[model samples]
Target: MSTEGRSAEPVSATSALESAGFVRLVARADGDGLAASGLIASALAELETPFQVTVGRTIAERSARVDPPTNEDDRTIVVGAADAAADTDDVIRLPATDRPATLEAVDLVREIGGTPDPVLALAGVVAGGSEPGAGESEWLLETAIERGLLEQRPGVAVPTSDPIDGVAHSTRLRAPWSGDLDATREALSDAVDGDSDALDADDHRAIGSLVALDAVGADEATDATAESIGRLLRPYATPDHAFATLGGFADVLEALARTEPGTGTALAMGHDVRETALEAWREHGRRAHAALSSASTGRYDGLFVVDVDDGPVETIATIVAASRSPEPVVLAIGHAEAALATREADSLGATVDGVARELAGAEPETEPAFEDGSEIGVEYDVGHRRSYLRYDPDLDNSTIIAAVREFR
Candidate 1:
């Protein structure tokens, strides 16, 4: 809530690394977070700089994950953390921004005299999910085109397998046939022929039109539905990455980050882990789809609560908040952990981190309590739109519901 001490000028990434005896890079366990951290780590590796990379929900957790504890002379760079600040003297923070952190990392890598892999850099931008209209997104795409890493093409927006599977698995478009493979296939029968692994321009347009029709009937607001359709119909900036297209690569990164963050980070760092990452992504999609389909949901004043026995809570929460839930915010609670996601248009203005702290009874004066083995602690994410909370296994769901109601 307080902005004081958060606006101090950030130290140059090059300077921070050059001045430190050693470096520790901490990134949130998300696609963009891993991409940003991986970009910096790749640059550092190229320079032969001693560094370690750790991934977690928060900076504290990641920093603590480092094996050989950092000393006074070591510099810790924290990226994609909402709670991080440029003013933190002991740590260098690359806080989230409208511009993808990957782009920022690219600049830093260049400043440090390391050439970033064009594909990896573009993947970072794609993983960020910035709108095509965004200046930064356009710049990144144009750069990719100039570097011959991407080609413009007309295609359906769903990044999944074929047209049918993509429509069924699409999180943005909540069609009537959603979650029903048979129904989806039947609905696309007229538009798509036998196997749609490779679609022509006519097939793309036909499929896009059907998707738009579905979006119009979605439960979301007209503006939201229109935005979704626009994105769905937008020109594809096809990438030459291992994952094929830009959107597909982003989806793989996202799925890997949620299911196997280590693999995601390795992939982002130009490692030959594509096969492993793809497998992890498929498993993640299976688990997430199952959890979302079976989950019970409750609508509150300003929040939508989803109760699930197990699965990826963060992924489920994000999907619910983004497309399914009518509420401005969503909370998905599983047996061991919980995730909160806020709609971009939310008017409450209360940050997820603030709500989480309140729920955990963590006072500003005693902030360190979160790191002192507290049973309930908030995990600050890379952006204000989401937060993760870990609570005691025995904690009652009723207590969480009550706290969330009070926060609303």
Candidate 2:
């Protein structure tokens, strides 16, 4: 009942060890300790012959001990896991489940065993998962050819029927392009209609991914579907979410632009969606720049001002407002606004909104609050029970805020 290194595959733990020539067990303490340990202990229990189980804490330590020539027992071949180290001629390396070492480990194992069958070794490494480190075109081709999974050509390896169909089906499933566009639009819209702020990166990406999937179907309704899908995606297109990593949505937009420029325009939400997506890519740069600029000023990096009016900001504001007393209202302001607001908030008792130019300033209950900026507001019940009056863009500012104050 050892939990260590147990493979889900039906093969007995001793069988896996015997296949690898009972070479040293190489596993990382952090990476594959549990799984590797299970397999090692299982082999020890099943084998009639005696072999010592040596645990290498680090990759360097493991590499130093795994050489067959230096080992005191010629009969004992070490089996171990390592993050990374020089490969030995006699050692068989199993990739750690988490953060496994380089793909070179596969070649290293094959090299030691004097067999070019990477599929067998990699199957043992990945267990049930797809072969590791084969996502790239070149790597996939090389591995496929080397393992006789693909027909080798001058430039690329030609996948056989199984591989070709597998790739195509997997791609479709990943993007799910066959869904009904109109139905998808309504369902997604309803999901977010209640609270766009509730939508996170994954949600937005799902919307983009739906659009991609719809476009792939290329049905008679595709022209209309493209436009409707774009409209649905409009609100979520911010500098965040990275605009869908694989760019299937962007490709869909480009294809739509050729067929229906109007839909493409709407997809852009009246602005260039590609340009905005590119800017989203630049967000990391902006954050890095902000981090570097603020680093020298002895400023705390943890504090960021989210524009309380922003869709995501509104979700937090709702949570804070509903939260128990002394819970600080969250503001979603821009980096520049955060910098300036932190400076002026103490003096003015408020921060101003960049887009609305409204004051989110605080004042005594007796004093009148600033107008216009009430659209983005905060509330708290501490000390004087000051309420930063505001509106959820979905509702009327006056009506909602007034109803909220009625509770106080």
Candidate 3:
């Protein structure tokens, strides 16, 4: 695997500020946060980018108060004190007086890289044909982990959760996605009813995610149905586990959405899934973007953030598609890295890029449609940071659907 670092010429703190699009300062209503905010504001002012500090109880609350940047000269940075980082989206701690947090913000957006073709690199790793250097491997692995396809163990990698065990009445451990949804659903229902309380954490997480997936994929599902499944999960799952499980289920919906047109409208699964996931995030008192940023199990390469500000939807789509879907696609929107990265599907990334181009070129549609019988057509929403696609089983979108059906 290629171990090349970003080839783009890195910019300096000054340039980063001049081009700053939005700046948000998030601090706790405490002394430390106030001090950090004062320091950060001074630092940004030196760089000619004025920063205003605000004290809030939570990042979501602060982010809600922040207006979008007015122009290219404007930017937003959230400086969370001791524990303020938990709620804020783009956050930094006061590292040292000599090395203020504001400078870190500059560095985040300044050092742009020529991210390797993540698709190709991931393909190589999956094929076992090439070994990526430490840096590349970290990116690929982290990307995969982010997608919920892999989890980091003490010294090895394992599937994030266990597979479906007994479909009906048997007792066996298998991938949850292994069999037909009917059998899997029945098995989960029985298990939960029988004695979910007796199951171990691993079993609970595995079953919970799969059950959630079944809820989303079912022909007839409602808000109540979704909530019930969530309640079943709540008794045994943490916010992170809930997030991961919903993400795993999202992968199922993404696959169905691609192969089955009109599915989005028929089940309105996209809206439901998105709402449910967001609900989970809120119930746990976590901001979706902040939670996603910290969700990485391992972080070797450091963090990167970008301001997409009025960027093309196709560009955003390319970035989202770069993430292996079916898992909840938690994009730190405007937080740019490699636009096309994956684990097993090297070509999937490239294919998504092509699909993104088609999406960008076509008239934006809120409704879904079969696009040239390939993938479903849907529009990308920047603020929502999501794309909703419909699945029409009647449509003969097999050619393109076949291309991505094997991704999982």
Candidate 4:
């Protein structure tokens, strides 16, 4: 096995990866994540462009079973770079509820001489990849529909939760055009601090249309459903962060289930499955909380904050933008903004004007809210900060669905 601190040329998959728009990272099965990361860092200095790697497989198989008994050997070879460093430390934390841009992973790959092709799509389906018996396609349909990134249609899901909307089709995860991780990250962050006035108008409009959908359809979904929708559009959302955002919703929903027995029954799942979802949500909460604590202690590489202001369109836009710093940015805000972020996104205008307009809805005066609540905006809404989102909204739910379908 190649020893750590030694340089090695990239593997032979370079050509194949070029076609797939992915870079291959190769790590020794015995390496630790830090060591692997160190080596990849060196390799990145020698590559053409940035890249991301998959560490070759899910986390479970990487740390154990790959040693002698598994026949693969115990090297911590991250499949990211053909020959970069890898180990337990570089884990893509169990994502809260959304998919990652593959930028960070790709950066590691590129560091090890792999090309970085940012993956596009929300990651709910891929997150399930690690779970046995999890249906990737289902997550794709469910989360995407929930987010309004995909329109509920015939094959995709129960249209409108009414079963009568007939057909469903979602926006594909892969953008018709290439999506840049940096650009996406920037836009997402911008949304966090956005003044609402400056947001690409499309973003605002898109958001507006979505919340309007929820308000319009609020009568259709059970109270739980409407609340569920409200829980998602947090002021601090990015595509990948939805995972954490959902955890809170899941928690509230769970509490709701305990209070309303019929709600859980309505899902029509076995007890074991319910247990599993709960188990996952618990883990999600724990992980997010842990991340938050780390950020609080200044122990991480990103900016993590729970205080986000919602007001003058410009103020909100500014806050969202600031949250996108590469440093981890954890945010907290209201369900109004959260739901608005994920719901009816497709129906909202996909232009700058549309996006900016949506920010206006956060105004207490403009939309529905509890009494005594600020009508135009909520200052430092804690509900928006989620350890998982860190304000990077580039996830394409459709892309996640596509990958899940491919894997399935």
Q: What are the TM-scores, per candidate, against the unseen true structure?
A: 0.81, 0.22, 0.27, 0.22
lDDT of 2 by residue, 193-287 (tens): 44543555565455445444544343323233343233223221212222221122323222332233333333322234554433232332233
- Residues 1-408, candidate 4, lDDT per residue (tens digit)? 111222122332233222232222332111122123323433443544343332221222233322322211112224221211222322222111122212233333554355321111222112111111133334434554565543311111111111111001111111111123233333234222445324443554354344335333532222333332332232222234221222222232322222222332222111223444333333332333232222221112322223323211111211222222223232233223321111111211122123223333323343444343423332111011211111112323232222222321
Which has the better TM-score: candidate 1, or candidate 3? Answer: 1
Point to the candidate with the largest lDDT. Answer: 1
Q: Distance (Å) between predicted and true CA of 13, model 1?
A: 2.9
Each candidate's root-mean-square deviation in Å?
4.6, 23.2, 17.8, 21.5
Model 1 weakest 10-residue run by lDDT: 1-10
Q: Which candidate, 1 or 4, has the higher TM-score? A: 1
How does model 1 fare in lDDT? 0.66
CA lDDT of each prediction against the hidden true structure: 0.66, 0.29, 0.32, 0.25
Candidate 3 residue lDDT tens string, 1-408? 011112112244345445655455654322223333444444455555655555543223344544545664554444332222232222223221122222233333233322222222332222121232233345654654565544322110111233332222111112223234355555566434445335565655566576566544554333334433332243211123322332233222222222222231122211344444332312221121223223222111211222232222222232222221323221222221112222221223223334334434343345344444434432121111222122332323332233223221
Model 4: ten consecutive residues of lowest lDDT: 162-171
Q: Name the TM-score of candidate 2.
A: 0.22
The Cα error of candidate 2 at residue 145, in Å, is 6.1
Error of 2 at 172 (Å): 17
